[model samples]
Target: MLDLTKLAQQMQGISQQLTLEATATRQRLDRAQLLMAQANERQADLVQMQELWRDRLNFTAAMPLESLDTRIEIAAPPAAHTVIATDGSQIAPSHHEIAYCYLINVGRIILHYGQSKLPLLDSLPEVFYRPEDLYVSRQWGIRTEEWMGYQRTALEAQILAELAQALTDEMEAPTLALTDGSLIYWFLEQLPAEARDRILAPILAAWDQLRAISVPLVGYISASRSGEALNFLRLQSCPYLAPDCMTHCSEVVDRAPCQVLDPLKDAALWAIRLEPGQRSPLWKSSARIQEFYGDHAIHFCYVNVGSEIARVEVPAWVAADEDMLQSALSLVLGQVQKGYGYPVALAEAHNQAVVRGGDRARFFALLEQQMIKAGLRNVGTSYKETRKRGSIA
Candidate 1:
């Protein structure tokens, strides 16, 4: 049981600390604007920074932009456009269980605006028990759940592509497909080469399908922490006098410029700059995985949703198309407005995908019954789990 009085006291103390941090954060944001304003004069520094550390750094255009400023005019979406979103939830494998099993639930919602009565909805929950699905890497003894997350991401993209492909008729309204997080599976870098290849191949296929269909699919990241823009600011502080930093600052410690902007999230940085419905200029990602993206390299932009800022990622094709970009921006903003700062389709999908405590309890009960029927050792509940289940009196 929680100590109510103590918990309240701790929360109050946390509130005070948050207030202090918020004040400091505001000051840092002001300083960030001043530093970013000077990015142009430091173009030579960026060039040097790139030349010295091209392999070490990840940048979209090979060279950091001389200016950190880009603003695109927001255009309203068509009244009859459709927005589809998918979200996923997972149950990780437990060692206490007889068999290593986990579940992935994907929920999809298709919302048609402008007098469309039919809104498609579906949810799929898959259980994996195959030897290949149970273990990620036998050599490393890693759990399959670790890699399943990336697989789920790929599955979501594949589902979106399938849905997009199904829309064969050319309607007046454009259809926009959305997923909850980044399009790039950055975690793939953490996996072994074989694991990465196995997981990424299908996602690559999905990307090709979406690109061939020319459908605008977006990966919406809320409160994004990416700092691709800050890399330019860091370049501005390059201390090297020449195009190569190998000799000058190589031995120096923590000399990157714009350390003042450290820990500032991308959404927070754009919150003050963009108006509601307005979008920042497209910024290409410098992720190493993008080398495999072929013509579908990922790019991102920040959108101002009035209540909060959000980072929206799209493929290079969508980024290059003004009509598609505007439609994505407008529909996303509209979705946020309908959901009160979040997308309604995503919210509904999340609601459908959620796994409640009651659901878990029922699942365990069924598992126990199955084990008993099979004449297998019950391996009764863990002592810790038993204690947690009891009520506090």
Candidate 2:
């Protein structure tokens, strides 16, 4: 009986050890599965890159540029300058409702207009303006209204025509044009080449005139909050606001000190200036910083601008400092890249106003109403409620 009892105790100990080992082995298997998943994701990304390169190479090889004796002209920055900031705002109907976006572009030019020390010229034509309403179907799956195909093309043509008129009538000749987004919309791919050429030709002609007079063109895009770089920054515990803040990620890794404070109240705030530094892993190889916010944050250039790059950090408390103002302008540029493929307008109508918590429900309600008004079909609510009866007598 004593030997039997000792044998039972040893068996119990061996069983417990086996159970522990089984658990550990299961955990190792789970870890291996997770690693395999990650590797597969990386492999997929590599395949996508290869496909993109193939497409790009094919497109470039098929399109050959006609070369001419084109002389390259470089323009020097003005000793004393006035900066003109222009922006455009639009509210257009999507498939189901309307959407709003704005653009702001800024540039410095030799003060040509009046006696005022301010660099702003009152006579300068508005670079940013809103055009007439365009009724178009929302085929892009972004918003859900279906309009005729020609509607989008017509609206784009009107926008381009208005832009050309503004450039000719109000803008000074030989002045730099600073745009908040890409010079051309990527959606141009959907339009016929002849139509695209017709719309862009005038704009290019205006640009050439400015270039001939030694005026440089620059485009700036802000950081996007929803972008991969900013998302990574948020995950890494960097300070940033949501929704209203710009979203695109920058590839440059540089830091500059900036004072972010309320100047009117004499209070201090947290602000940092961005200085260009080494390339970051986050940036695409060809990316360049048009504006910098801090280490690992910058507004990147998506289009070529012939202007000299300058950066300045300012205290947030100072109500206005031109150099600092330019930094703030950089954020607008970033927003253009992240939000809409256009520059931000400088006017108050185009300003990115913050929505308060109290207004959240109201905003959505208005949006729903607008969709209804726009004739977008909707499905019934997906909710049901049940009430329990009180105790019966």
Off by over 4 Å in 1: 4-20, 41-52, 56-67, 115-117, 169-172, 242-258, 365-388, 391-393
Candidate closest to the true structure, highest TM-score: 1
Clash count, candidate 2: 30
Clash tally, candidates in order: 0, 30
Q: How far is candidate 2 from the true structure (C-alpha RMSD, Å)?
A: 20.6
TM value for model 1: 0.86
1-393 per-residue lDDT for model 1 (tens digits): 678987887887899999999998898789778766776566566666666666654332223322357666677666788887888888777765545678787887878889555887887788776877776466554556676676678778777777777774644477788889888777776777777777778877877887677678888888777877656555655444442445554565874343566666667778888888777766777777777678888888788887877888888889888877788888888888889989888999888777787876676677778878889885467666576668586
Give the per-residue Cα lDDT of candidate 1 at 347. 93
Against the hidden reference, what TM-scores do the models get? 0.86, 0.30
lDDT of 2 by residue, 323-373 (tens): 333333344334233334443232321242223344333544565586688
Residue 299, candidate 1: Cα error in Å is: 0.7
